[model samples]
Target: MDIEDLHSWPDSVEEAEALQERLRDRVREEPGPAVVRTVAGLDVAYGSHSDEAVAAAVVVLDAATLRVVESAVAVERPSFPYVPGLFAFRELPALLSALRKLRATPDLLVCDGHGRAHFRRFGLACHLGLLTGLPAVGVGKTFLVGEHVEPGRERGSFTDLVHEGEVVGRTLRTQTGVKPVYVSVGHRVDLDTATRHVLALSPSYRLPETTRQSDRLSRAALRERESDPASAPPPAAAPRGR
Candidate 1:
């Protein structure tokens, strides 16, 4: 899977914000693949002992069976500082590296972050979808920049997540009697379609298999990097301006 070099990496928070503003216009909120054969989950894990150290994981699964098809991980230091709305700048590079290592090109991407629901409407999932030219959805554990009425407890129930009086996403209940997840369109996918995909991916667990598996793999990769001296991360860079 090849990622498009859409823009240069931003070095400062101002630059990151500007980039997001420019690229946000390119995100297409339309129907994606009519028949998704495979789906990939993406996540990143940070080392507890070192703020700079992080691991990104991508797990591809057969959509019909929910069986693992391919996976990859990349361990590296964050290239940017931790800014509230500029989180993608810190993780995108590492996640792209991990994505490039995958042998399979997934039909859809499920990111553990917000997309159109973001403050700037360009979260990790949107950035990744634009770069990869793949249909993507963001299934966040918490709300980023939206307000929604509590959805019904039944699985498949959802309500519009509105930000600034615009329908940006959905607060979805993926499991009966479990906490809901936030779902948003990343790229080339509509909110209804994205919500359906998320529910299908999460049959039993509160989170979809794609997120659960990738999260576990990312943590494992970080643990392995931490235990091996040869794989130690470089000296942490000074925090950049916000």
Candidate 2:
């Protein structure tokens, strides 16, 4: 897979906000791959310390079989503040590195974050899709900046996630008697298609396999890094801030 670099990585909130405004237009509200063969899940696990570091994991799976086709992990230090909406700057660098290592190009990227359902309308999924030029969608466990009535306790039930008079996403019930997950379009994908793919990927669980597997892989990667003699610090070590 080819990785397109971010135009700029701004560490400050002001600059990052400016960058989001400049790049938000790049997101296309269209359908993704017609014949979905592969999908990749992305997640970043942070260290215990504020400025310690992070490990990004990309796990690609066969859309039909839901089996992993490829997996990669990258570790790197933070580059931006741990702001609510700007964590992308800290994670994107390492996530892109892992994506570049993949032998198979993914048809879609499923992010464990928000997309258009953000205050700036450009969350991690939106930012990642802009940088990689890939079809992406965000499936979040909690509401970011949206309000909606509770969906029915049945699989496939959904309601509009409206924010500031715009339906930015959907609250989808992937499993019966379980909490709903938020779905939003990232890039090169429409809200309907994004919801469909997320449901297809999550046949039995509240969260899709993509997110679950990526979560496990990323956490494992971070733990492995923490145990390495070269990476670990003394017990009396203090947290590092940005």
Candidate 3:
């Protein structure tokens, strides 16, 4: 997948916001896949035994069985400062590098963050999907910027996450008698499809397997980097070629 952005790494909040504004319109809210064979999950882990480094992990799974197919991990320094809504800028570089390491082109991208449910309507999932031209969905653990009524305790129940009077995402109950996860359309995907994918992915746990696997992978990568000196970030990542 080719990631297209006029500004790949923005230093300031104004520059990042401007780049996000430029790319936000490219997102498509369409039904992604009626039957998905493979889905990829992405997450980042910070504090890798050093404040300057972070680890990114991408895990691809067989959607039917929810079994891991492939996984990749990349460690890199934070390219941008920590900003609330512009998280993609901080993590996307490493995530993209890790993404390129995958042998499988996933049918859908299940990211551990928000998508359209953001202040700029462009979150990590949206940025990645727009760049890769893939059907991506954001599965956030916590609410970012939205107001929603509490969903039912039963699994599969949901409430509209309204932000600025617009339906940005969904507060979805993926497991019975558990806290709901937030679902949002990333790119080339809709709310209903995103919600359905989330439910399908999370069978027993509060978080989906994609998230769990990737999280574990990232932390492991960080630990490996801590013991090994050869794990430093390269001057150039193949930048994670497809």
| Candidates by lDDT, descending order | 1, 2, 3
Question: For residues 85-197, what per-residue lDDT tens digits would candidate 2 score against the true structure?
Answer: 78677777778878888987888999999899988999989988877788999999998897999999999999999999999999999999999999999999999999999
- Candidate 3 achieves a global lDDT of 0.86
Model 3 per-residue lDDT tens digits across residues 1-242: 45564344565899889988888998899875788999999999986343477799999999989999999988888767788998887788789888877776889999999999999999989988977888999999998998999999999999999999999999999888999999999999889999888999999998999999999999988888877877666542223332
By lDDT, the best candidate is 1
Clashes of each: 0, 0, 0
Residue ranges of candidate 2 with Cα displaced over 4 Å: 232-242
Give the per-residue lDDT digits (tens) of candidate 1, residues 1-242.
77776877677788889999999999999976779999999999988843568788999999999999999998878878788878877777778878888877999999999899999999989998999999999999999897999999999999999999999999999999999999999999999899999999999999999999999999999988888888876553322221
Score every model by TM-score.
0.95, 0.93, 0.93
- Candidate 1: misplaced stretches above 4 Å? 234-242
C-alpha lDDT score of every prediction, in listed order: 0.89, 0.86, 0.86
Candidate 3 Cα RMSD (Å): 2.3
